[model samples]
Target: MSAALLPPSLSSIFSSSSSASNPYPLHCVSPPFNLAASRPARSFLLGATASYSDPSDLSLVSPTSDLTVQALDQKLLTLLRQRKTEDAWIAYTNSPHLPSPTCLSRLVSQLSFQNTRSALTRAQSIVTRLRHERQLHRLDANCLGLLAAAATKAGHTSYATSIVKSMLRSGYLPHVKAWSAVVSGLASSGDDGPVEALRLFKAVTRRVRKFNDLQIVSNSRPDTVAFNAALNACANLGDSEKFLQVFDEMPQYGVEPDALTYNVMIKLCCKTDRKDLLVFVLERILELGIPLCMTTLHSLVSAYVGFGDLKTAEKLVQAMREQRTDLCKILRESGSEDLVENDESVFKKLLPNLTKQSDNEPPLLPKVYAPNSRLYTTLMKGYMQAGRVSDTVKMLEAMRRQDDRSSHPDHVSYTTVVSALVKAGAMDRARQILAEMTRIGVPPNLMTYNILFKGYCMQLQIDQARELLKEMVDDAGIQPDVVSYNILIDGCILVDDSAGALAFFNEMRAKGIAPTKISYTTLMKAFALSGQPKLAHRVFDEMLNDPRVKADRIAWNMLVEGYCRLGLVEEAKKIIEKMKENGLYPDVATYGSLANGIALARRPGEALLLWNEVKERCRVDKEGGKSDSSIAPPLKPDEGLLDTLADICVRAAFFKKALEIVACMEEHGIPPNKTKFTRIYVEMHSRMFTSKHASQARQDRRIERKRAAEAFKFWLGLPNSYYGSEWRLEPIDGYDSDSL
Candidate 1:
């Protein structure tokens, strides 16, 4: 984000607000997966949580010491007065006379009352102690500011307030510089923070009469800063009346609204949910004698959208057209028509320019058109999203016409289109696109790998994706991110290749990319779907025990359903309880499997009872309600649902579960279609006596037994009185009487 993008608070976070401080560095909060030649693998291990020791859970080092906190305070106070908390923080920490840890805590409290500050735990306690002792440092407002900053950093809010109150009572009035820091901090905290911070500024403003903090601390007259802070507060609060009142009062108090002031008010209008109110504001701005800029116009259009006033939005767009008619005529005459034939699209191209002027670029802010990479990519993405391959191709052609060969879709552009193709089950097209990207000299990024990996996995082409992984490593010199591994492993799991998935994981570990939530989840899914609850159990246990890596809820649920499938209700219940303890919830697929599992365990009564419970919880009705405590069991899976379930089982090669699902479908009076029957026949044979592992079959009798099992599964799903429904399709020559 740019500095101007911030209303004083976020300027610092992006290292442009008055000074550079990495006070609250933005953590990814998600997998920082880069299955490319970017990040060093070591960083991955660092981000993962190994254990949760409270003190060790966060950074404990400070940039400065306490003894010189007095000097640091002076510099900090100066920095704060300049609205430069980022720089101020650095100075405060570099001091030898740092606040004692207790004093540091007190300081945190004071800083938290700022408009956009988060709370820090250690800072809050210290601030509380400082407030209680009344030993708050009077000299270094810097110390006080740092303390509050720390509190906010730690997410401790209450203590931050007390610290602010302590500062106010101490006769320390702040100037725009000091106030801006607080305001920015509060803004960053949340939208509500700015509102509350404004009230605090008002209280301080009121106290100015009794305790002239500005005159005491500085050698200058009051500037427009305090008013700006108040205005910012009101703007974010979105109380138009309050904002106008503040605006009116600004002139009375010898202040004037600058570009920032107007920008804030306009943004408020943009975010306005009320069309009439926004229109009223637009009219009011005109009445108040301020010229409307494109910024104001955009805000107006945004407000119309908020109110769902497309007519008004169209009218506004038309009005903008009238204003830019001369420019549009010039563009048409200049022969740029072929590049963007659509006038509306051309207008869309111009809006970003108006919004994204350079800070140093004379703030006249001309009607600029800055089309970001996303806009073009979105058009391409739109075609891909709709599953229109031809349209997607057209989009690529359109992009080529608009941009130079040196400029093509980057990671996002390629990934979005590839992912959609993969999801649509169009592996061939996806591959072609990848090839096209490479041909265009736009080397594939990690996103490219993820897309291809997912597509290959879906098609059971695990070996191809693996080959790509090797290319990514040895050839591309890229380390596979956790997501890349996850997708590939998930594919392996789907194909019932636990051994293969495990080998990849070991490869992943050797390459130094530690497993993540998805990794564990995919492994768990493999075990659950493969009728290996033991392996699933071990994977689940490991994930839950480690706080550093989150557990995959999908995988856990799969295990619970697997347990239920094998007639282990107690074990399923135990896993369910464990999931609850971990704050995870079971999804619909998990419940469906469990319901079916319950019926097959010879507990049709329990299955019916549980099905109703699961249905009510999921807010999805299950067939018809049961009788008794529960009447009918929900084991009768619908054909559509069974087809989907079967597809999942077949993809994973879970023949046992797939056969069971077929039985469930028939029980519901749903007949298997041709596609499903073919899948069953092909996959059953593959599992029993075909595919890569066919030679592993024990004997010819084993193959005959497999055939018999398949036959039993088929006939059991057919109507009892139907022709040949009870016909034994297996070879009877190898039969044991006991098996029958």
Candidate 2:
């Protein structure tokens, strides 16, 4: 991106141009004034060649002579050809002479060849100055095309398109080569520009067709390259039908399909699993006597493997090998015979350089196309997907045996096999493959260890997972990332080892590997399930205080569940309020947890209220197709959720709601336990008959509620207030009075 150096005299010339007011600095230099001024006017006239002027004349001329401009053009082209782009640009801009379109084209073409961002920017600026500032409307298509291509190569596809479209609107009718270049450039810019490339292709084609209608001869017709670029765009979008349609219309557009066109078509067919179309394409290739290139063979083999026709793929490989061997044998046999030794007279007539040859030097052999790592890996992936794991292993061995260096398996090649083995629950086999990878000098990467770590955790061998983590860090010298620590944390929680999980979490934070939301949620759930609600609350609070990590819905829900599990329903409701203040809302699991806890506490009315609120929120979120604030979106009710709600209703003595839940469960294709429902029903009737005991139970709950509320109020910064006098120290549920 280094800016080109310019001499002071040329700089002064460019300083006079109106473009000097432009904010952007130019990469090209201005021309010398003396070169333009000293050249005679007749030198630029008819039939007289212009001479390159000297820098000494850089300050001698005004910006008025055609002779001076022609001399500068000659000097600029010479400098450009010599790769002195900066000097050429200086001459182009400041020679007191306006450069011709030819000079502009060559200047841009040479600038693009520099292949640097600075060079491309200079080219773009030159085009802009010529088109607008200099009022050069009749600049040749070649110059504009080169500028567009330069922009494209710099990854400015949109700017390139605009340049091309602007040229078209100006009645320039850009050459087909320019259209093809722009379209292909856009199509190859990953997934971002394929649609635009196709759109441009269509526009060019329509314009070309209109020209034909009026019988006007124009080179604007989309050629094979243009259509092939559009076809490639179709392939990128995975539009198999569009690929076919484009291919079919090639003949109508008078664009003959070449090897590249067929290759892209074959790739499309294979990707879409259109085996029949592949066969037809192959037949056409043979009919046209077009020799298949390496890409063609690779595509065909990949297609067959994808089609589960391994036998045909193997035949193709075998045929290729035989062809190579036969070619080698013929070459060796032909090299063994020397015409000079057999006929001395013919040798005398031979060229002197060919008459003598060294026997030590072997004859050159033809290069054979061989499978590389990418091709082998593609086949291996196909085998893995087809459940032919053994075939995948054999293919790896075959790749290792190839004579070409590229056939050697890299990290991806070995990892793919291990990953497949891991997926099959064959951890031991996967380990063996990993060992082989190391033995062959292909060092296993962090991804390899992570895969193995996941496998061990999936098998519930947390101890082994810990060992693998240490091995990855200490032996491999690769630092474990957040994912590695998260896996271990989850494993510890899965086995009910909350203390171990907490230790890992702390270690993760101490290492400066920030704990993600999942990390916090996992520990919170473990603490809650282990009946350590206090520790769970501490985790939630710590998560809130950490500025780096934001507490998501899952983290909030886990905290609420921890409080609810301890029968501290009031604390749980406070969490819901806090979440609302933070523009968050509880999800279904939050309500389910609250319902279970409330029902266990014998508070049916409160449980029903939570359930109805959850149901209504889920409905609103579903109907509106949007969520308010940071509220979590509604989740569809599963069988487990319905069962939890039904149990809560039964425990709350809401018989009608309990029956409704049962009906809803059945509607969702989950059969309710009729026997359990009947037993609950009977219990409800018996409880109804014991009116005195039920009254006493309600009175006891009222007293407990009053005590808990006064304690909460006293704790809310009113210890000396009159309302605090009613707050007597008393245990509510299983917690101590102070614990509230």
Candidate number with greatest TM-score: 2
| 655-676 per-residue lDDT for model 1 (tens digits) | 4445555655665577756466
RMSD of 1: 17.2
Identify the runs in model 2 with alpha carbons over 4 angstroms from their true place. 1-74, 77-83, 90-102, 128-138, 212-218, 306-312, 322-740
Q: What is residue 27's positional error in candidate 2, in angstroms?
A: 19
Q: Rate the local accuracy (lDDT) of all candidates.
A: 0.52, 0.64
Error of 2 at 437 (Å): 14
Deviation from native of the Cα of residue 264 in model 1, angstroms: 14
Model 1 TM-score, 2 decimals: 0.44
